[model samples]
Target: MNIIALEALTFGLGRLAAASRKHGCSLTLFTRDKTVYDYELSLLDEQNIKVVEIDTFDDHAVVEMIRNEKDVVALLSSTDTWSLHCLDVSKSLGLPAQNADAVRIARDKYQLRNRLYEAGLSSAKSQLVDPRKFDNESVIKDISYPCIVKDTAGTGSQNVWIAYDKEDLLQTLDKAAQEVLRGQIAIEPFFSGTLYSLETLSWKGETRVIALTSRITSQEPYFREEAFSSPVTINHSISAALEVWIDNVLKSIGYGNGFAHTEFMITDTGFEVIEINPRLGGVQIGEALCQSLDINIYEAWIEMALNKRPALMDVPLNIHKGIGQLIIYATETGEFSHIEGLDRLSAHPGSPRFYPTAYSGKSISTIVDQRASIGILLAEGETSEVALLNVFAARNKIRVVMKG
Candidate 1:
């Protein structure tokens, strides 16, 4: 069987291939670059990274191409364009993108809200807008006050802003609009509460939640993720609302199969759906979960994509507690200069939770959208505070020198 991966996010392709091989299945990688593709092929050629040769996402032609192929399987996408083409073209071939209609919920936040509204679900009351008129005070009043704003397509949080008052709201409109390439955007009430993610796997019509973990983000106004952990280590009763919301959310989004990474807020108002990504949770959270629980979610994801649900997934929950991850965000942008404490941090007792993601010489971006421009410091621990401090400790130990 061929496993077609989308992008190499630090380590996506390797993890998928390792897991697939462990499950006794052969795999191939589909890369966007001919050179990098060939380069990886040279490295993992022994491990089965075959470059996916395709020109465009023409639905019919792709269907014909894969019709005679071996057990070929692909999953939901991450990179914007490739992800869409994967869904549009692959589902046309009875492959993974089964929840084709649900792709939009991930692509456009407004689409997510609309489907939630129709389903009588509670969420940040939001609506779509043209970037040109987004600053109009009238439009601000349209959503009421103290709302959040960001580009529709995805500035990756470039100009995303949270307005506590009308003035801040109007002031951010222009900057925020400029960040969106689509000139379209979304505005919603700023979420207030603890945020968490339920990175789960769903079979045909049935939802199987393996991890209900909490997420740490850049002190939001622009809520880009910084780190994540497996198993929130909380009782199901405490997260009962989340469990209900998850089941309803999958049904509402029309997701009958595949993996889903959902972001939500647990507030006094209840579990409010923030947004959902119909793919594996990044930061190797899924891999971490697999390590802690002895299950290969990535492999299970591949199986479902190929129209087969491996029986090993039913090997009982075995997961007794939740895990946590903390992402230490950078305060400045510059090439990483010197580093310290990774060895000591790694040596600390009770399983060290610190990891620095910056590689000296890479410039970082301080803006929320540019937050990732700085790279991440990862940590995992039993409690949120432990995890958070681990991330902080790692960040404190590292330094980056900007080329001035």
Candidate 2:
């Protein structure tokens, strides 16, 4: 049997491939651009995974190709861009799938906010703004100052802005008006606190909080992710509280199966919902989880596709060492040259390893978001805190040299 992935995260293909083999299936990935997986593909063999180049956005073409394939057991997708499309294809093929309506709500930021607010799970409500017919006065009146403005379906922090005052809000809205958006523009009150993600798994309405991943982002107004560490240490009381709260949040959205990378803030009031991704956390998060938990986390993805309980649910989470990942960004936008100070990594504590996201000669036009990131530097330590410190120290030695 074969397991089909519509599209996957930049990392974790090898783990997914191995997991598929463990379940007696070969992994086939359908993607429009194979080069996106260059770093991951270089590490794998054909027997473990096969990559088929196709315009995955063409729904009819993908469905036809799946029909022609032999012995297809399950279809899956773990990307924000392809999640809904994958669900549609699965439904058309009479394959097991998550609730389409639920996934729809999860994908739209406005809808998700409203749903949570109506369910009494969210403190702030979101207001949808039509960028073309934007009324700055009305939006300000509804949401007030110190609010967040973002594309309802934005990803990778591409179209997110924080408007602290009138001028900032107007400028942000005007900027948003000039750009094409994936969904409607949404404005919500900004919550001030540290940000973290709950890596969770759900099966048949039951959920498990696998681990907590701490996030560090670029300074105010620009929310580019800078680093991450998994298995954050929290007291038992807070951990239990988060588990219950996340369970309530997921249940409100009708998300009953699959992995959820749920981002939130622990404000002075309580836990507030940021966004929920119905997939594994991206950017070497799978690697961090694997190292911290000492298990191949992707196996759960295969199990869920087959409509069976995720084996990870029953496995005891024996945390080994904490893992931290730092995103290496170019200081200036230009043609990718090479990363300097690689040799120095060997001298750094925590056994730091670098994973390149961009290759030499690739044009880099921006250094404001994930686009500017050239590679990731990962390391391990005795605890998540120490791991984070180790990765940051290692990251300090590296520089992304770009040719102007």
Alpha-carbon shift of residue 87 in model 2 (angstroms): 1.2
Badly placed stretches (over 4 Å) of model 1 are: 22-24, 33-45, 51-81, 91-96, 133-137, 155-159, 310-313, 320-324, 328-330, 336-341, 350-360, 365-367, 370-391
What's the TM-score of each model vs. the native? Answer: 0.82, 0.98
Model 1 per-residue lDDT tens digits across residues 1-404: 56555544443455567667775666654444444333334446464555566553454655565565587656435445455677766656666465567766666777777778778886445677676664465576656667877665553445467888767776776666555364367787776788888877778778777777667667756666666655666766876756667888889888867677777887887777777777666665765677567666566755665567845447675663334454544455554454444566565423544333444564565645434443444455555446555555555555544555
Predicted candidate 2 versus true structure: per-residue lDDT over 37-152, tens digit per residue: 99889999987898888899998899999998889988899999999899889888988888888888999999999999999998879998887787667877856779999999
Pairs in steric clash, model 2: none
At residue 28, give the lDDT of candidate 1.
52
Instruction: Point out the worst 10-residue segment of candidate 1 by lDDT.
Output: 34-43
